[model samples]
Target: MAISFYKYQGTGNDFVMVDNRKLAFPASDESFIKRLCDRRIGIGADGLILLQDHADYDFEMVYFNADGRLGSMCGNGARCTVRFARALGVIEDVACFLAADGEHQASVERDLIQLKMNEVKGVEQIGEDYFLNTGSPHYIRFVDDVENLDVYEEGRAIRYNDRFKAEGTNVNFVQRLSDSEVFVRTYERGVEDETLSCGTGVTAAALVAGMLGMQSPIKVKTLGGNLEVAFEQVDEGFKSIYLIGPAKQVFTGSVSL
Candidate 1:
């Protein structure tokens, strides 16, 4: 069978998107999904996203890592899925969608998407580093020089450490550029490599920065491009958190399954 797919990218976090509202895709085939995301042999994406029908929301986002496993809530993938939903006329400017983490609200203007993440109640400080879940687990380490760090090696160490080796976690290295701006690079677990960008990781880093007395509406610079995270610090945690960035369609094609 020939399946039509769209390629989308937010920053440099790219995904292979399929409109699976009809449930035609074989989602249970992990090897096929892995092949689809293989850079050398397939569609070459950081992950794959399925847009399916949802009874209570605009749509349902089903995400899979490049390794073909069902992944946690992927922020950039969600943003790209929202853009795909808009392209399919499933939503207008505003949308509410169901993801792995639960319900989420977002708005899209042209290619820019502002996605509302889940409320975080706490941040765990592991030494000087921090750990948090912003729809996804992330380990945030404030560094001195982000541009020259060995993200793959250092992030792999923490991600595969004794405490986090089982389920795994995304690792982020952040360097504060100013009071409101920081540079970040991430090593995502599912992808098992240093990706150009990571939305959930960026959000986690921003919240940690806020806890360290930086500010809200933090500007983030990544290897792929730039993104912004805005939130309100509540008494218990953070609320009204928004991950703002641009998600654009790279191309569209049909491939045999």
Candidate 2:
């Protein structure tokens, strides 16, 4: 069977999105999905997402990492999924969708998307590093010399360490350029390497700094481009956090898998 797909990108983290509301796609096919995400062999993307019908929410977002493993919520994927939902008439201008983590509120404006991430209770400090879950797991650590650090090697080591050996985690090396402005570099798990940008990783990094008392409305600069993270911390935890930026549609075409 042939499946129709669309291509979308949030920053440089790209994805292949499919409309599965008909439930015709075989989401359980690991090798099939993996082959679709292969850059050299098939349709190139950092991951794949399926938009399915939901009972309560606007739609359901089923995500798979590049490795073809069913993964947790992806911020960028969620954003693009919102756009796909809109294009498919699954949602209106604004709507809520269910992800692996939970329900999320989203909106679309042209190519830009604003996605509401998961609630963060607080940031756990381990020495100078911080850990938090922004939909997906991320380890945010600040380094004095961001320019000199070998991000791929260092992040790979941390990701594969015993702390997260079984299922590796994404690692973000952050450098505070200012109280509200920061630079972020992330080593993503599914990609198994450095990505131009990671929405959840940067969100965790900035919010971890905020929980550490940086400031609200943190500006994070990633290798791909600049993004802004805004939120308010309540007694229960940090709520009303919005991951705002452009989720560009790089290009679209057909490819065999």
Candidate 2 lDDT over 71-100, as tens digits, reads: 888887888888888878888789898999
Q: After aligning candidate 2 to the native by TM-score, how far in Å is the CA of 158 from where it should be?
A: 0.5
Best by lDDT: 1
Prediction 1 global C-alpha lDDT: 0.96
RMSD of 2: 1.6
- Give the least accurate 10-residue stretch of model 2, judged by summed lDDT: 248-257
lDDT of 1 by residue, 1-257 (tens): 99999999999999999999999999999999999999999999999999999899999999999999999999999999999999999999999999999999999977689999999998899999999999899999999999999999999999999999999999999999998999999999989999999999999999999998988899999999999999999988999999999999999999898
TM-score of 1: 0.99
TM-score of each: 0.99, 0.94
Q: How does model 2 score by TM-score?
A: 0.94
